[model samples]
Target: MYRGRRRVSPAVALLLASLGVLSGCTNAPPPPVVESTSSTPTSEPPTEPPKPKVVVAGIDELRGGFNPHVLADQSPVTDALSEIMLPSVFVPGEDGERVLNSTLMESAEVLEDTDEFTVRYRIRTGASWSDGPPIAAEDFVYLWEQLRRQPGVINPVGYRLISDVESRQGGKTVRVTFEKPYPGWKSLFDHLLPAHLLKDAPGGWSDTLDYGYPASGGPFAIRAFDLDRGEVVLMRNERYWGPPAESDRIVLRAADRSENLNALRSGNVQLGMFTADASTMEALRGLGEDIQLTTMPRPVTSTLLLRPNSPQLSDVRVRRAVLAALDRQALVEAGTGGGPAANLPAHAQVLAPSQPGYVPTEPSGEFADGPDPERVARLLTEAGYEHSGGKWIRDGAPLNLVIAAQFRETSYEAVANSVADQLNAQDISTTVVTPKGDELYRTMLATDPGVQDPPRSAGIDLAVAARPVSADSAATMAAQWGCPAVDPDTGRTSEFNMAGFCDQLLQPTIEAAVTGEVPFRRASERVEPTLWSGAVALPLYQEAQVLAVSREVSGVRDGAGFAGPFSSVGEWVGAPGESYDW
Candidate 1:
């Protein structure tokens, strides 16, 4: 089992107290209040309440604006921003469970025993947007039409199944009829935009709101956005129907990895998130006990994806030999700094170990603990390869393979170097390539265009990348490894299926899992074995999201998955008597 949070050493705590950073030490009692010296009955003017302290948070760049309907802006930063400024019918809990947001919705249920599947939702009486427009059924209808028409947008799979939406009781009640049964209907309307704002935009609904959001319906509203300065300021929504936010304002700013660490050391930022490697955690420990670290398993897993079209990996034996030559445990330890509490070896591609529905596939005898040179040589020989002059040669040609990873992922680059060294020691010739920016994505989605006499290889035999899984295990699995989503008109493929993995034999099982025809565990069990046997991708380990906070901050909670660290920001409170100039 994975631990949610790890405690620091006792020596670090002592250092924090000595530096006057830890505020939890013992304190003396306060003095009693004394009576006023003067007996005059003169009245004094009332004093205004002190302003709430601003909490500065560091995050990556906010790409694609705040509107998630636009495919480009649907990033982790957008997810965090939406949690603070949008109204949702269902909210995700810290334990990977969904709960109703009573502030926006009163009740949601499915009509029983009907030929047509329909869901009814009742909006809260006082729910209104920041600009004084009521949150009505018309907003949902508009959202459905936009998403239904734009199939290639961010998440249109579920909306495409809905046939119609009807509003009753003057926009208070909504009825949604689906073309088929969808057990995961609660995940549909997590964020809804105000219909009145975008209904009259010029070009199209998908591309109209690409720059910034105009209004908010949640606890916080956008005060200012300066793209050139890379800063966004949010203040409490005075028109909110629920209780006021605990903190008056939040400031999100873009910063590099080094800048984020420096800000935490100087008390400029109260909280930040990063991919915690061992070195980063050690550096934080040196900064004293004032800095606190908490970790939770992320929904992403690192894998080495193989191109089936490549001649070197087209043979199943050659793929098996490649797996047997590398030590997955060492790679995982090096990538995560040997912190068992922070990371775990990945056993399945469809679901993370901490997720709800995960089944461990039986290990193949090869590559379980460490490298097996004997197994590698045996497999290579069976595939008509022989060792010669420290390299495997077949048909008088050297069996050289190229491995590549993105330059931005430093940890992954280190792991790729280590893999190359290990494979070379076992008489396999492997070269490592590091591509930056657009070149990296192009390499991952490489395919033959059939323009030449002989089709060339995808230019990479194996690529190192991370696959992000969702709480809905079935849908995520289908999207990652099932049939490719090809455009009917352009003959272009969806970006989701970049690996180009298409197995018709498993299509029915994937459909059953996606449509909720079978239990999650049963579907997972039936699919994981086939995925493992094919060896198209090899998962190395699971990554954990690391959050650093100051000792003065409280009410910081881990999200259900990768929703964001600020899911519970409304309840956050700073230390008493602390002064923040913002």
Candidate 2:
């Protein structure tokens, strides 16, 4: 069975705000500093307050699972770890609208194209890995070459986006070319491994067991990892190339929500990360006035993937019937208590709101204010299905559905169970399958095509996956879907379309969004209709991560969750502050 990592509580967030302690960190301007009119007339300028010393801890710790070259479950652990290392590229921005961070390379640009493509990067002079080794262009060259030769290496997303790479002989830069115009190529820069560190990675780069332990070049390095004790401690990297981190040491201690909350109250851990279960949130009020909390929605969407290829699901009529049957509003309310800001099911595609080409689509069925069983029954009837012996049937078979649920997603499981009940009420038989974590990725996501449909290797029928895109660049369509390759000569397609869906209308629009040479606005107009109007995938609730710190911490600003758990790691500071009781 899969275990769940801790999640920050929203009720607690609301409660904290009610108490007027440091609450949610929003981008809103700080409540205007009230002016002391007469007293401030004296000629002295106001002095700034000292930075606060912030200590942050969470239930999840860095597991040294930071290598992006290999396939692994993405989580706050990996997200936090990525900031310290340099990708050949990085997505820099909020709400999945990230851009390339030029940590090691000064600039990168496309240099050549063919069925095979090539782009070049100019490395920043004097850039060195945390180990003090000079970074060379051949590092990426070697990295890509290894990826190409490895068979079990299933990072098709990167492979689909990148065609090939070449290390410039007698040069200070590296060039990579793609089979097609992969709009999301910029993500490669987010983290690039230092080739010198893992040149002999065992079983080749495809062997995750060997490749997993490769070197890191971030601001911190793994000091210790004790899984049985459930603690991973990280220490400052003295060889860091960027501005130094304020804390000399960072301890990642794993604990449950109750333990995390207790640790916070006792000051055993300066920060606590826990899911905002009802009890945890309610108890935060008693955690004292010195605690600070902030939360932001994650770049993820929970969804139900309908296998259109299934004998019972392929009909547009059936797809429409299923949509009509689900009470998404009720599902969100039951799962989150406070429904999403909008009643609309969360969009399934990974495009962020800030993405230049993002378009909002309407739900496909009778998306009303609430669930209506009569309306659901009516849709089923219109689809040529009839109620017989108190069950909906088509082609002499009962309408039965088996939904695969990933383990440890308690909220999602609740939602799935509720959905099954609703469908059964509508005379449809539905079953929920809860699978273990590894099996979920391999069977559900990799093979089933339901969790990650048309499957990343094949095409996905439907899936509810999280995808973050770069907001800085004009190209914002998620690489997972829009980056599908087209044969240069035959003009045929590659099986990378996550939806396994290709509409004449959507195909042209997706192509324009990815390969169009026009401005962002034009591309958005073309792409928006498909996303917002077609409602190919439903958008559900946005997720969030919360940070709680001691009053001593300062310079902590509001940021997206994925950038890092301590996203403001580069800016956090600590100084003397009033005692906890005071």
The local distance difference test score of each candidate is: 0.72, 0.55
Q: How close is candidate 2 to the true structure, as a TM-score?
A: 0.72
Candidate 1 has a TM-score of 0.74
Candidate 2 lDDT by residue in tens digits, 1-582: 123445659998788677665444555566778767675555545465543333445664334344544333445555555554554455446654554556656777866544555677776666667677767766776666554333222333444445556666444577777756665566554456667756774543433422133445666665666666666556666776767777645556777777788877877677655446445556665687888865544454555555454445666666666666777777665555442322323543545443344455443443766556777677678878888899898779887776655566666677678778777877788767766434554444433222433432322233433333443233334233343445443555543333334455545555555544554566555665555433345556655455677665666665652454455555655443322211
The digit string of per-residue lDDT tens for model 1 on 1-582 reads: 123335778999889777664443558555699888898865544555565667788875654445665433444566678788878888776565877788899999999977888999999878988989889898899888776544324345566568888999989899999887877778778688878888987744655555556778887887877777777888788889887788877888778767888988887888876666677667766778887777766556777877565668878788888888888877786677665323567778677777765656746573557899899999999999989898899999988888877665666787788888888889889989887523444334434333222233346777776666655667667766766544433566544343556678887887677678986678777777777777778887777756778876777776665556676787777543333344
TM-score top scorer: 1
Q: Provide the global lDDT of candidate 1 against the true structure.
A: 0.72
